[model samples]
Target: MSGLPAFRPEALEQWLPRTLQNHYVDLLLRRIGMTRRRADCFVRLALYLFLKNCQSRKELPKPPLTELSFPQGWVECSCLEAADVFYSDRDRGGDRAAGMMLNKLVDLGLIQKQFDGNCTQVKFHAMPDLLKSDAKNLHISFAIDAFDPRSDAIPIANLLANNYNWLNRNNDAVTYRIANILRDWASQYTAGLRVLRRSDNQNPVGFYAFYPTKRESEVKFFEPPSRGLHLSQVADVDPFQMALAGDETCRSLFVRSWVIDSDYRQAAQMELLLDAQQTMKKMQQDFPNLWDMYTLIIHPSYAELSLALGFQKTNADPKMPLYWMYQAVDRFLKLDMQNLMRDAQSLN
Candidate 1:
């Protein structure tokens, strides 16, 4: 009761996700591969969860990809109880609607679940205990760059530790996570750079992992995020590639992470996008064989964002959540990027 907020609809209106009331939200969500119905369902659920967070007096998690600062982890509850709550139309016994939503959300990289043999734990991609202080007063900001673990490891580890309590809470655990990131990044076959952040040039905030790979490699190793580790699968998409197995050359690239923190919204986001864009743009200089780009989007924002960047879904079904997208390098370079720098105030 102490940490929770009063449940008043109008009073809590500000906290609701746009998807609940905005038809445009679902329309945008559809660009990432959801059918209109599924998108509507997801937004309703998102709004429901937001209300729950308020009833519990929890803070809002940062927006996915764009507003991403840190992954604070999930809310823990039994599967049965969660299902009942998620689908309010249920009788004393809930129907399977919750399960279907769970599968789709997992496929989209929006949430994570862990089974404890007794009860299941759920971690929303962005949900919270509320920020104790105003983000405006925090005075923290990030600059993305080619990741260098040697110089950037400690601060980055500390940043991850501060927000994600589910982490092992030790130096070794952070190291292990870094190792996993490297393994995922290694799959890229094209010329690419691993992205990291420098917070005020001292700390690290979020990971917008980027990798390079061949199309054949992606088809061979591309695993749906719902089936494996989220971090691995989130940035697991590579854009293009070059050279085939034997006596054959190929031109395609797969991007493991084309993450753009949309919380920053248009202007700020384009700046971040340019950082990665420049890297990919440079990859073209030495390796002219580069062409297509591919990714299994991690966040719903990424779906439309990718679409805006000139990507098209491959084997996409509106009724289904899972999707792989492709874009040609020739077209990507054509986007106007006149506004490519962000105001320092957003760091707060």
Candidate 2:
């Protein structure tokens, strides 16, 4: 095993400059969240899309390429839909075939579904993590709707700074300007999306609002067919128990943070975790098709607290900084309060 943990290609790009052609190659490595040859394929796909301004070579959504368009020299439209592309690659597994190539982008927060019914129109949002702070005001909003179908590419500075704010340090003008130059070079060379932001004050602090994107998969647990089969087998399981069953349908749980007073961070997070487990357990007890519950990663800064609560890490990647963790829903309820209190020492 290598000393350095593996990263997906998309995650790798996050480490490099914000604006650079072939940014996806590095990111692709990060997205797979592992070291593998397929990461190379991700890079090639990025290159192909960069040159053609299309995501796929054959004009087919198959392999669902995101960064580039297709070559003008190509004649046939392939007329093939994403479903066909998925089925054709069924050996890779339907989910992997239809969605694997693009899943990394979603996981990295580079792309998201606009959620139009059935026709499958995916809109990409690029924003920088930049938060401008000053004595008077803080500008913490992204340049929205930057991606256009007709445009050949997005500005590198805009994409990098847009999606990633960790690059921006409070009110440092020099770093921000240098970041712009790097963005320009990336726009000219690479083909990937970014998140953008701009703040008013030169140096500001505390409480900037942000809208981070979430990944959506077509796979949902409550859907027909399998629901009936699984519901009967696990009728009495607790939400935590159901989540551990590990069925495809259980993967659709959506998680988001709720705003509360400053003093409530610890309490609020705990409550939310409990609610999420209860929600999954409810579905498990009431719904037949549901199996395992899907959970989101806790924010990195808060992870130590979650671990103390008995959440086991399911993902490991240095580039991600954040991680997703899980525990049996039923097991969660039986956790000893004393143990939780003892482990809480880490926070002190």
Candidate 3:
């Protein structure tokens, strides 16, 4: 039998690009190392609803349009409610096993979750992977104002290869797994990559994974991290974006598998870090409510380089288990009142 009408006639093809539709079908069959058909169906359902309400030329709304109104019959049958309906329709299975499929969809960048007031709403963007077409080399560009030499900002593949080599040699299976997880996770957030070649002799390095510091704040974890020892509270984080922590606490912007050629290691890595830091600060400056800067993770191969650059380890765990470091820039500058207070105290 033909598949049930997944969406209203107007939305079926309009919601997803032809390339994305083909990609989704491929992802369903192979699972991209993690996805499923049911989840794909659910995402399709979300796509239908989102297209029915949202216009795709603009960015997908983080919380979706707050004013959105769902048709009564549509709401009752919506895939946004799929989790509830799917679980109830089937026997209660293991925790999250039901939503495991949804998680995979999120991993693949087909859907995202957002909080609207007290209720949670999911938004679907059927955009294909931003960094498609793996190549032997790539060239990446960064914000002109934010460029630096000592940053963990490079193509994802280079980052992965560096980490994979380091972890494999060290026999750290966990780090390897975490690296894999992060690669997949970053894929969802990537916007686009444009290759900019430096030299014909040198192969293109890799594409930049642009995480717009302004577009990621609503993600649950980006909330101000706890004021733990060694952790500094920052006040300039961009509203739309913050880095992902290797650990669950979200204190560090985990940088995994970052590799550059031996010759350019110092220049390339440092440039990326400095750029990321400056860009982050600029974001924070624009959005005073957000924090300024966070730590990063690199392969142990870069540990010596990081230490030389003043990145200290927060833990002694030999596993080197994604260590956390901290950095902060003073958010408040002395104003007339503070200067007056300082003057009075100094006189006393």
- Please tell me which predicted candidate would have the highest lDDT against the true structure: 1
Across 1-348, the per-residue lDDT of candidate 1 in tens digits comes to 122343232332344434334543323232233444444444444554454543355565433212212223454444444454444443543435566666666655556777777655556654221121223323545566665556544444444343333422343464456445544444433235444453655443444444444445556334443332233223344323334222123455555544323232322354566666787677665556666666665445456467656678765434435567778877777766442121211111
Query: Residues 311-334, candidate 2, lDDT per residue (tens digit)?
Result: 676554444444455555456556
**Best-performing candidate as measured by TM-score:** 1
Better of 1 and 3 by lDDT: 1
lDDT of 1 at 257: 45
lDDT of 3 by residue, 1-348 (tens): 012243443334454554565455443332222224453455455554554343323434442222222221222123334444234345553335535555545544445655555544455552322213111223532222212222223333344455445334543343344334334434543322222223543343432333323323423223332311110112233233333322123222322223444333322443444444444454343345443333344333344334433445553333443454433333221113223322322320
Q: Tell how far residue 94 is off in model 2, in angstroms.
A: 53
RMSD of every candidate to native, in Å, equals 10.7, 20.9, 21.7
* Native-to-model Cα distance after best TM-score fit, residue 174 in candidate 1, in Å: 10
Candidate 2's clash total is 64
Model 3: lDDT equals: 0.37
- The whole-model C-alpha lDDT of candidate 2 against the native structure comes to 0.32
Reference-based TM-score of each model: 0.47, 0.27, 0.31
Best-to-worst order by TM-score is: 1, 3, 2
**Clash number for every model?**
29, 64, 27
User: Where does candidate 1 have its weakest 10-residue lDDT segment?
Assistant: 339-348
